[model samples]
Target: MSARLEVADIFRRHGEAYRQAHHGHLGRVERRVMSAIELCRTAALGGHIEECRACGAVRVAYNSCRNRHCPKCQTAVARDWLAARASELLPVPYFHVVFTLPAEIAAVAFQNKAVVYTILFRTAAETLRTIAADPRHLGAEIGLIAVLHSWGQTLTYHPHLHCIVPGGGPSPDGSRWISCRPGFFLAVRVLSRLFRRLFLEALRVAFEAGGLQFFGSIADLAGPAAFARLLAAARRRDWVVYAKPPFGGPEQVLAYLGRYTHRVAIANSRLVSLADGKVTFRWRDYRHGRKTKLMTLKADEFIRRFLLHTLPDGFHRIRHYGFLANGRRVARLASCRQLLAVRAPETAFRAEPVTDLPSLTHPCPCCGSPMITLAVWHHGQAPPPRSAWNDSS
Candidate 1:
């Protein structure tokens, strides 16, 4: 029942040429990703290997890559993650904020992914914390779960941070839980201005500390004046900081995280066709309210686009800070929950939200209406033995 066009499909078609083109220059991660994708659902990794009882249909089931970049493998990963995080969800409102670099800065970031992207995360976090802690604002310590995304739907380099934030936070003394206004979380305009200033400041520091390198057309930026001019040009353009209303509740926040936390440059569900050495797929046009549409690209072009999002070795895309910080998360979370006076609710966190909700709003694709949950799937296993088949058969 998998409708996905997985990495295995692409690798089966073109991994050999790609490996040949890179050869010894290939990093361990890229090689591993390629190998995993190639072997994903084939007979290489053992599984149930189901066959239809009535028909002669046969299928091979194998293990997943579990590589963070593999789109087809994110569902279970997201569900497991959500289950673990469900305990940490406070009853307070949660907001979604996005910080995006201007095109000029993004160009430089594309060249120095690890360094520039790390700086982007730091500067954005600092900007939010500083602004939120000011006496004029809520004046409390904030927390965030920031996920970095490096590509647009078409796999272009579009680095941005997607933050899932609790609407308020513990006061500096930890006495009370501060809450933001019902609708307004933070000011996008202020966040944008401050983010631009802080990021440029951090970039200058990185350049002076010999953290940046330039080649090709950008080589001239090695000079302070050239870099200053670049920064000034970027400053003249508007940096975008978009903040949306609070996600309705914990369930909604988990649902949102499930989608974004493990997402890759593209997903299997988006691929439409592969024929005649060309690939066709769907992508979102964010510039126009995310109108969905289809696009076609040469096979080589498609591979190139996919490779554009290959992250630097050992970089962590998903991060937790403040209350969710690894060292402090447990204790702080307990205190926060106590302050909020609401215990985390118990639910089927491992199930997909669409499946959990009543199907009236989202009709089943197979039936065009609500579908009953006939069963729950366990990992690499079957449902409990049915009575009729237990002894009679």
Candidate 2:
């Protein structure tokens, strides 16, 4: 049987060529991403040996790269993250809202990622809060969790925020929980207009403070007149703010969060093949009835598109705002539960105990018994010989 293909496979096979072709253009983050994905779960990074306590069956487990952008590394990370979030789910209905930038602004964002992405998160959250707080609307403070996704189905650079918000929040007077109208959240038009104005204003401020940078095709924007024109053109367009129907309940919201929170540019399962100097992958064409289609690109182009979504060092892609903001979350949640007369869900996550041989999360394949680590090795070191264990790579 043929081994499964992964993003790591593509990087290991064609990465050096891609690096050579685009050496002048690649950034530090992109280079590191390529290297991490290529070396992930490989002997170069080292591994440990485990034995079933009952049957003595042996297994070899590798260390993960744990790079946020590596597709192979996010599944376990997302699972752990969602487990921590399970207890935070409220009993109220939740809404999924998205705020997307206009193409002109997205072009500017591609060059100034750290500044523009931060602006995107802040303005989007502010718009939601401002609109929901209006007496004419819900008139209550709402809490939301926003996640940033920078790639489209075809791996194009499409920057947007996916926000999950509860149906309501504590009233301004703190007397009661104010629920939104049944089957309705804030108006999309209001949200879009507010988001656009706030974002453009923020961009103008950043430019004035010399916080944004431009290069290559957009180098002309370094001039004040050209930059002003770019903002003016963006202002003339209607920004997109989409609000999907409210989720059935908190359970559905958790499932949805699990899928979106730690997604990379593309999952390994999407790759159909890589052959003859081209890479083929599956993508959903949402504009065309949500049909699944095959897209093939030159190997270099495929690598380029994959690296386009690499985030800057220490940049956060997930954030909480309003009542869910980090510092006040525990207190606000306690107050919210009291208002709603519901108990918080029991937390499902517990910190694993530390020891010389850490416990493995998985059980032995042959005997279904607990597996205990027998030996460990660091990078550049080889594990002890175990004839029973097969190397999958």
Candidate 3:
């Protein structure tokens, strides 16, 4: 009932019960995620001590688990990632596009995350490259940054990829930049068709290669005939590929990336309450004019929903492709800037170094003076008690 509520609070209180209830079905990644979130920023992980120079006020700070799924650990990580991406922006217009899998395919993806998700990323990227490369469309090689998200507003499993792309790219001959029409980026209908066909074909190949696994309710899909039927049904419907209008400029693109790049299923700020075996949070209803709404679920159900989004270990959720692919990014970017006759942004993109000591940049609450690190401690070691410090001073 405190003013400060977190997913950690819910996990610490009810996670064990959920784990025991689902022991037969719980996964290693999900179990680790729950443990990491529950122990994050607690004495169990240990941390450091800081003191105010002006007033001699001291405080203890705990270490973060730094797990990607922890809501408490993503802010600084996202900031650093955005900083690295700052210099990569171009002066031209940028567009936002989304590729979504249908519910039937999404169900299979939920069962086999790594293979299906990888296929989704590759097929989505290929769809754009294939369509944009055609002489009829933009006639230029393009680049994009794609981020994968597995949850919808209410924490439902809805796998999709959000892509940020420049308005155009260097010509196939490496001669010059080719921009699209003033407001348009690409044809969604064309993109949707290709994405559907490519994804189904890739899924078929993966199934044939024994790269996919089906279980429980969907176990029947293990058969070639059943799997063929699933794909055939998916083919009958149009896949969703949406492209928003071009951004006002590069600045808007950076802002959008900040919100999405390191996001978790739900943020701590959205939490409303945890009481009486229920957890409440805020969500938006996109189907009904984006209306704001609140959802409350049993504490156990909340934990289950949160764990549905644990990514496979070592999986990279964010990726670059085409001219922005990791290997070609630098040279291609320099060439694009030269062709456009534009200089890189005035601000330099430098990554701050990691440090264990508390930063002196934060002002002390007691004296309004800088706080300096007084001591450092590692896991399993506790700093001196407050009483001991006060007595010594």
All candidates: CA RMSD (Å): 7.6, 3.2, 2.3
TM-score, prediction 1: 0.82
Give per-residue CA lDDT, model 3, range 1-393, as digits (tens).
446899999999999999999999999999999999999998888876778878987777889999999999998999889887998999999999999999999999999999999999999999999999998999999999999999999998999999999999999998999999999989999999999999999999999999999899899999999999999999999999999988897678888998999999999999999999999999999999999999999999999899999999999999999999999898999999988989888545455766664456356988799787666667777766655443312
lDDT of 2 by residue, 287-365 (tens): 9999999999988889989988999999999999999999999999999999999999886553344356365546889
- Residue ranges of candidate 2 with Cα displaced over 4 Å: 347-361, 385-393
- Candidate 1, after superposition: displacement of residue 119 in Å? 0.9
Task: For each candidate, give its TM-score against the true structure.
Answer: 0.82, 0.94, 0.95
Worst 10 residues of 2 by lDDT: 348-357
> What is the per-residue lDDT of model 1 for residues 12-57, given as tens digits with 9 covering 90 to 100?
7987887787687666767777776676655454333333333323
Per-model lDDT:
0.78, 0.90, 0.91
lDDT comparing candidate 1 with the true structure: 0.78
